[model samples]
Target: MDPVRNPYSPGAGRQPAALVGRDAPRSSWRVALERIERGRSSQPFVLYGLRGVGKTVLLSNFRRAAAERGWITAQVEAGAGKSLRESLGETLHAPLADLARPSAGRRLLIALRTALSFKASYDANGIWNFGLEAASAPGGGADTGVLETDLRKLVHDLAAAAEEEGVGLAILIDEAQDLAEEELVAICAIAHAAAQDEWRVLFAFAGLPSLPRVLAEAKSYAERFLYERIEELHGDAASEALTDPAASENVRWEPSAVKLIVEESAGYPYFLQQFGQDTWNAALEAAITYDDARVGAAAGRATLDNGFFRARWDRATPSEKNYLRAMADDGDAGSSSGTIAARLGRKPASFGPLRANLIAKGLVYAPEHGIVAFTVPGMAGFIARQPSTD
Candidate 1:
């Protein structure tokens, strides 16, 4: 017997290529990359949104498109304390090495080593060696301050080399928000240098809402450019996401199920995937058409309960869970911290732990000062539907 397909892609980031509901954004990105390849400055793009908004997948698509355009592409996921220069340099090296060519390879090698000299371990012989140690060292003998210069030269030389070989150069950076402070400044410097020299360095970045802030904090010039935000779907796009793919696969989604998803997801991509997964399971368990009644019936069934919702549900702390339910009950007239304190029957500051915990879980955010709300639109509704223990 074949196993049932898991439609709920809670792990959206793990499958970048099979992303759904992002065609418009992908097309826009392709256009941006095309401009960069033609020696025009592509807008430095930042795909910002809350967690599970498909920002990561969209950025990966941009990277893939850059490669197809004969551009040398490299990708690195940024994190605190990680050397963005070394990561960028490592990814850029393969194509750069390929481009290094007869005598240029030797010169580039010397230059790379010199640029990276601060890290004494990155010797000439050690550059090409594959191991954890080489990858960790500062890239090439270039001073970190002149990372902009070294990277600009790397791209220019690589483009020249690629042009000779009938190719071009592109760079993809993910999680741009997590970059170390100095590394981020260096990256902006490189972007400015690329623009000044008209070098063929193309970058596509995706991260949490803070990413644009980080870029601007690094260099205000980033503000002069336009960055596209990949928002949740609505209206026709949501309908298409629900119906088009299912219809093509010869599977029919009950109109009610689709509507339920739209209402529950509030058009958020992650919730869309979650609702879709749930509806599919609902259809399977009943051996009946997946209509509103069947889905409603399935809601109480343990099979569906133990599915996507429970997975996310189980991950939340008791206090965070309590906080969510409190929000749901408070309705549109949001609860005051004092009101919440009274209802929860605890010290005013006692809710502090739960509030901060919920925010950290990414389940809620402060839309205004002292006013926190669920990060997902349908979250309140779902919480409302659950049994209230307190």
Candidate 2:
């Protein structure tokens, strides 16, 4: 087997060779696009899940699908050292530029002017030239220095322009749980308005499992948004995810080998791909066998431990690592805040900053009131394997 022919991809947000078990969400997004193209509104999609569950991959798929349909699509990630206003302004520029022309529709011209204002709102020294007389267009009030007011004006005008072109607008945000509270509230408000007014725009957000709760807290209307919880593949879907890619390379996996990798990876897409790649490299024959799977799984685990899990583990301070160690006793199911504090011989109130810091670093999340869990799967086991210094 040639390592160069390996079809598996294992990295953050990397698209898999065979994306399986996501038909429901993908179909729903297609329907949403069609509905918007037909002057109908669709509920925003909120995808929440643990890290490495393929939320980013699915969101990227939605972006590609919308772009294929000629929609005005801008996909951005929050918490990347840029404000929402700045990130959205920068991402929307290229698409908006593509739509600019001398014979552009009146509404499109207006949208271009509005976009200029939005860009100016964040970057006073920078500007965009759409090669049209947009300065004289009838739209340009989006630079009001208010998030809700400015974003609403920009999106509304853009949606109108999209409708004029017989398409739609799409705005997708990943790592949404990292957005500022005010920014999240503003987005929810604008999305609510778009739905009520039947604007030709669609929104999708992806983040940690706490994303839905975060949205609800931002705006009550977010309660009605369509929330899809992405999890590991199961049953036959999981098997197909591993087999389909290998089949494409004209390789076969013995039933015992497939079962070994599937069970060991626990159906996680990232883990499956890692093990699949390793197994492909380990197999000397055209058919992967159980022995090869054992070696590959071990190699894959070592790779994850050194790179994936260790990276996050090293980001924690010693005090935070102690806190994480206390939580590891509960495995991946999460730990009670009170119990973690009791284990650390400290009051729960005193450990609030530690818990908050972990959450801020994206290593953990509060799944429910007073219960925090690792945002990454199998984190507890990784933590447990570390040498103890306390």
Candidate 3:
């Protein structure tokens, strides 16, 4: 087996060789795109899950699918210290530029002018030359210094331009939970109006498990948004995620070996790819064996410890580490805020800042009212393996 030809990819937001166990969401997305193309409105899709559960990967897939259909697509991530306006403005430039021409439609010219105004909203010193005369066009009020007013105008004009081109507009946001309150409200408001007015635009958001609650808190109408909770693959889907990639490389996995890796990885997509890669490297024969799987699982766990889990663990302060250590007692199911405080021999209110810090660092998230869990899977075991800092 050659490591150079390895088909498994195990990085943050990396698309795997074989993307399994996501047919439902993919099919829904296709239908939504078709509906928008037919002048029918569709609800926004909200994908919420733990880290490494493939939310970003799936969102990327959605962007690709829309782009393939000639939809005006912009995919962005929040919480990178940039506002939604800035991120969206930057990402939309390339596609819009590709669509710009001298004979562009009236609506397209208007959209270009609106986009220029949106760009100016964030970067006063910067400008976009779409190589078209959009100055005399009708639309340019998106630089009002108000998030809702500006975003609505931009999306409306762009959606109209998309419809004129016989396509649709798609806007996707990853890490939606990190978006500012005003940003979230503006997005939800525009999406709601889009649906009511039958605008040819589609929206998708992906983030941690708390994303649904965050959206609902931002706008009560978000309750009606289509929410898909991504989780680990199960049974046959999990097996296929590993086997299909190996098969494509003309390699085979013994049933026992596949079962061992699948069970050990707990059907998580990231863990499966990691274990699969290690097993491929460990296999000396054309076919993977159970013994190779054992060695690979060990290697994969070490890699995750030194890389995935350890990176997040090291980001915590000593106080935050103690708080995490206390939460580990509850395993990956999450821990009560009061319980963690009690374990640390402090009042719940006193530990509020610690919990908030962990959440802000994306290491932990509140799944419910008072229960907080790791954003990454298997984090409890990783924390338990760490040497005591106290």
Q: What is the lDDT of residue 61 in candidate 1?
A: 74
lDDT of 3 by residue, 75-116 (tens): 999999899999999999999999999999999999999999
lDDT per residue (tens digit) for residues 322-343 in model 1: 7667677776334566666777
Candidate 2 runs further than 4 Å off: none
Report, for every candidate in turn, its global Cα lDDT versus the true structure: 0.60, 0.95, 0.95
Q: Give me the runs in candidate 1 sitting further than 4 Å from their true place.
A: 1-8, 14-23, 93-126, 129-140, 143-166, 285-288, 292-390
RMSD of each: 6.0, 0.9, 0.8
**TM-score of each candidate?**
0.69, 0.99, 0.99
Sort order, TM-score high to low: 3, 2, 1
Q: What is the Å distance of residue 45 in model 1 from its true position? A: 0.9
lDDT of 2 by residue, 262-349 (tens): 9998999999999999988999988989999999999999999999899999999999999999999999999999999899898999
